[model samples]
Target: MSRRNPSRNGKRSTLKDEGMQGDPHAISSSFSSIAVSPRTPKAAHRMGLDDETEDVELRLLGEDERQQAANGLDVEEQSGHSTHSLSNEDKRAMVLLCVLYLIQGVPLGLALGSIPFILREHLSYSQLATFALSGYPYSLKLLWSPIVDSVFFVSIGRRKSWIIPMQIIVGTIMLYLSLNVQVLMDDPSNHVTQLTFLFTSLVFFSATQDIAVDGWALTLLSPESLSYASTCQTIGLNTGFFASFTVFLAFNSEAFATKWGVPHLTLSAYLKFWFVMSYAVSFWLLFFKKEKKEPLSDVDMSIKAVYKTIWTICKLRHVQLLVIMHLFAKVGFAANEAATSLKMVEKGFLREDLAIAVLIDFPFQITGGWLAANWSRGDYPLRPWLFAFWPRIGFAIIATLIVYWFPKPPITMGFFVFLIIHTVVSSFTSTVQFVGISAFHTRISDPLIGGTYMTLLNTFTNLGGTWPKYFVLKGVDMFTVASCKLQDGGSELVVKATECVSDHGKAACAEIGGDCITETDGYYMVSGLCMAFGVAFLVLYIMPTARKLQGLPISAWRVKMSDS
Candidate 1:
């Protein structure tokens, strides 16, 4: 029988020497096999083979072998950190991360959900649309994301350095803004500009902080525990949003205003609450949170390389398709969302009533995230996303119809019930879609440059959700019913020839006998058009593209850019 030996390729050849099996020096040649240390230096010296340069042949394992070894280490490490079949570190990290995400949510909820309602009484829909641009930094965070990725404090931890400082700044601003909300609003002429400045700055800090938080997620949790990380995001974000939107808006209601002996819920109170929550997260992160230190080799600290990676990712054909879908996915909803509050206000719904809708939708949002995670696992991962796509289109269409034919009077019990159900169902499906896409993005993002890749994907989706509001809000005014002056230095009414006399600073027009009101027709027209585009996008781009890409390996999605 032939003796087994190391092959020319450097792999161990198959074992064939049965006679040598009992020899202590005989090597096991199975790929799954582990070898003991080379014959001790004593044995080599005894054999007169102990040249100083002929040290023990220590070869690095192949990539697959190395990966298997790493997996083993991960299992062992996880076991050591786990108790009662759950990882303590993972649970603790999840809780801490969720709190951090909730902190992020407070500002986001205000920007995306509450502020619109607060300003609706004063600003026209077009003016409201302009406010959405303040969040434009969220969509363009990718521009600075690479810098966040490439720079870090080694001692304080890469992600935490950014997170801690940004949190302090954001928290201080929130407190300062809260203290002067009334002062800022006192000048109705400068209200929009002041708000745009303050909130835009807030969002800038929030967006930059998000870059650090996201990068931290990569280092904080193992790949197997990533779903929990997503859970932290979805739940924490929704919770924070609920607090800011429904809870804060509830405070902003006339009931609260009457109780507090103020004209409206004091913005200072809300801001103070957010300030506390923001710093709580920051404090926890600074004092308690710890990151796993990776080797310097793992850190890519080059600004140029970071941007190059981002550009390369953007230029990928598959990613381009994903970006397009992301940019268009929420258009239908964006139009409705931009107009819903205004339409409801026109229907005499109070801020508290809208809070009820958010309240109804909150549970389903959390549930949808969990369901999306479970459904998107294993062999048919894309199935859940496809399922969500159809229902989303259906909801968009249905929501459009509701707006097109919304009743003139204050909402009835039946209509309110319908709105509740619709909010729940639509929020659930939308959340499902969001989580599915986010999970997909996470899966494909290179761990080597996670912050930039994830941020890019997320920013595109956010921009998609936001940019549509500009056109929708502007277009809705083009279909306005009343011709009159806007209140509180808001944008001029889109002057339509009408019976109402122009009267600035008052809701009522002299000729109309009551407050000048815009009809819901604009809501119908804008939403309908947006829905049509949404439907076309799903059929023409999303479905076909998803089909083509569904089962492809992650590596297959990689594009070879010239610069890359």
Candidate 2:
């Protein structure tokens, strides 16, 4: 294979990587770039030692330097001076880099969640298409991970190589987007050009930044600290998401022209402005360097090898259980995120109401996160119970509420209360399960195969939610299909199915939409039940260790290879 030019790419870094973060773009791009082969330099043998370049390029230490450092040879003492420069205050600069680097997630996430919501008003897609747009690309990023693993923008060593340039690229694109888009912060119709241009570009940059950020961060930490790193990663991401949703995306004034100086300040404009400001974090991130553990190269890059991981995940019993449960989790949880804004719009709820929902639920979500973190320290914190009992039981409770207990008017209060409780439970449950699943694969499986093994179950879950249902959404289609059936009592079957999907007597289905119209009560009820059942299987058959911690039954989860 032809090699990429070293001069054009820069001298390559020798440090490798451990895993990916949110998106895999950087990972996907890694292999495709030109690299300088790592080799021993002649200078190391000829000259005794050089300390000048040690601060930046010290990664490829000469044998003598390594031996000296390991042997506690004080070059500082021998030279009667320290070759190193800088003081304690200078070391504090590291915190600034972390803060700035970690800041990239906000604008990126806002742009991501914002694009679909703003653009949806402009383009007409089925409910399924809209839902798919928001969550689908996230899952597919795994397919691109290996590629991001291999490519590099510079050979200038690792930190200055692919990651630094990609961030610069992302910042540049975001700057361009901000410069061109006139009314990005306002609603779609106020846009100067077609809204699709703004949305499509925003999505691209956001996704691009995601891949790059995840790759860069993944390469910076050791495997032993991944759990802590992952927590930090999640916090950074969620914080960014919260800021974008509440502060930037939530337009509160009477009109865009009034609140923003521009006469027609659009949602696109606001988002572009945020991107311009937020992406500056990338430029700051360009300076820091931390050593990586493992790196992928051309020798191992192959379609078969990538697919082989997927096949392996499918064959394992424990892997299969994780995959199935994760899918249902998304299917249950995503429906809420997908439907929330639309729900707000329909009930004549103001954008502020949606904002309120986010605020109220966010704290609850945080509480749940803390609960999840608690599990990391103990034998039965939350993961075992989460995967064990919550999902299906939550499904059953929410189902009953929708069908019989509370499925009517007073829409805003009812919806908010339900979600606050629902999301809190889901968050805690998911956190435990997510981390638990990772621990199982990371600890029990071969290190060589760990990343692939973890992602395979993730893929199975993605495929479950990504595919659309043929019938109208569960609640709405029942009646419409019931009306269409001409067979003996086929029409009645649809009615019964519709009734089955909805709260017992409530007309929760949307008048204008197809069957799967979801109301607050109906959604809560169905999703809770589904989640509960999945949890039950996990507790009874999959994980025997689950009940010892909680009062749950020992025989509830699905059996796995590890269990046996």
Candidate 3:
């Protein structure tokens, strides 16, 4: 007769039914008997059981053991703490997510950074403003984020269903645009409608893909490993930016044409390459990558529930404050960013020079992200945001000074050195601030509605960073000493030169060429505006908010999902 043993769940099991328990050498075949109570209140309630009374069985010994072994988690209860360690699957997840993030950065770098320089000569300040506005979809992605969160093709994996299709659409658009690049470059004014249509569609599809990627990241990373999310984003996005901004520009640059035996590559060729890369990566992910098949309970896929969740997060007091801060934080930098490239080109800086400067500054951006992630982990987690904002404010002032005083025409070696230093320091400050802010957003965001919540906050942040560019571009004409409306019939020809006289006390405006005649009144105005806002932000928002929020628990922020 076999003896019976009682389980913690109050079920009696015979030794004969499971395995012989008395043999010292017999490893308990009742390993399957080991059960896990729900670690979360939501999970407990969803299953209609209390944490103490739940009978969750571990079905597969090998997989569970591998996870625990990889992460070094003890079977012994530790009361709600999970120390992060990278399993093989977690490593694969990071690589895939990082690559996807890099892909997202490509269009952004071109639309926001590179193309402005490419079209600088052909477009007016107002037209440039229109170009900048083409990126507005990024800031408004939250509106359709719910669809991304809820709708899915279960056959092709939940997130991939969104990501793969969007990538294909993006590639097709880029292919068409690439083929039309030369025609548009030849007659930009006439092609404005076509250019706007294609670019705008690109932005829309890219933003939708971003929503899916953000939601996918939530499913891919456990809470313990979440801090690394910002690092992945920083590195990956910057890498893509490097490709779009530096590599693309380098090939198109005069220096590369002069030195290399190879001819300068056309913008169309670059775009074709971009299309191929996007499609290749998408196809590889589609065939090779495997998303962990989670139960539907992992995410509340109900559309109503997602909207309700988004509303709840929005209503939280702390969340409101954070959103406002993010919205306002970059107001100082917005106009500065939009006008600087044009201004630099006007001052005789070549495309190659700016490309090289960005290349040199890239390493510092990666370092800043790494440091921010490590520093944000211990005591006073929010301290990095508070500390970083001040240096950035100072850098903004320095940048403003650079714009104001640099002499018109003939950029000297000394001036180039100054520009390089400014670029490096600015990149460092911006990266630190970005990493801190991103981590803060990730920490506060509920994984339950990751797509909507993250995009909502990012939209506000981008609004602060980008919208001011529209006004800055508009205002550039305000302090103009002279204006020339260049007509595109077959060649660049000045149709009319209005206000040919100097306004900002420059000598011989009609003689002195380029954007110097524009007088930088817009840049000066934005600089002063940023300084004022930075001071107010520091005294009114950051100081008090950081002091209050730094040491407190996450739940204290009032954004914690009740079920999660």
The stretch of ten residues in a row with the least summed lDDT in candidate 3 is 20-29
> Which rank order by lDDT, best down to worst?
1, 3, 2
- Lowest lDDT sum, 10 consecutive residues, model 1, at 23-32
Over 1-564, each residue of candidate 2 has an lDDT whose tens digit, in order, gives 222221201211322112222221101111110111122122211221124222313332344544443234233124312134434433343343234334445544544455544444432223324333433444565675444444554434433354455455555656665665545534333442444343344444444445444444433433222233344445555666666564444553244336555354354465466555554654454444433333333333344554544554455433454555545544433434344344334334445444555556555554554544444332243354355345634543453344344334446575667755664565445444454433333222222323343344445544444443211134322222222111334332222323312222133333422243333333444344445554555556545533222222111111111100
User: Which residues of candidate 2, in runs, are more than 4 Å off?
Assistant: 1-104, 111-128, 157-161, 164-215, 222-226, 252-266, 285-318, 332-334, 376-426, 430-432, 449-564
Candidate 3, residue 378: CA error in Å? Answer: 3.1
Model 1 Cα lDDT, one tens digit per residue, 413-457: 899899889878876777666655554654454433344556777
Q: Model 3: residues >4 Å from true position, as ranges?
A: 1-87, 218-228, 260-263, 298-300, 407-410, 481-520, 549-552, 558-564
Q: Pick the candidate with the highest lDDT.
A: 1
Overall lDDT per candidate, in order of appearance? 0.60, 0.40, 0.59
**Model 2 TM-score, all chains together:** 0.57
lDDT, residue 168, model 3: 86
* Tens-digit lDDT string for candidate 3 (1-564): 111111212111110011000000000001111111112223222321223212221221245533543243233124223454677766777787778877777777777667878777666666667777777777777778777756776777767888998988888888998988888877675666677667778878877887777656655765445434444555566677677877778778867778876578778887888799789988987998777544433233356655666676666555677677766766666656778667767556788778878888777666665766556543355677678777777777777677667677667788888888888887666665655555454444333333455566666766667667788776765555444434356565442344332222122232444332343355576557767877887788767865654433332222223231
TM-score of each: 0.76, 0.57, 0.76
Which wins on TM-score, candidate 2 or candidate 3? 3
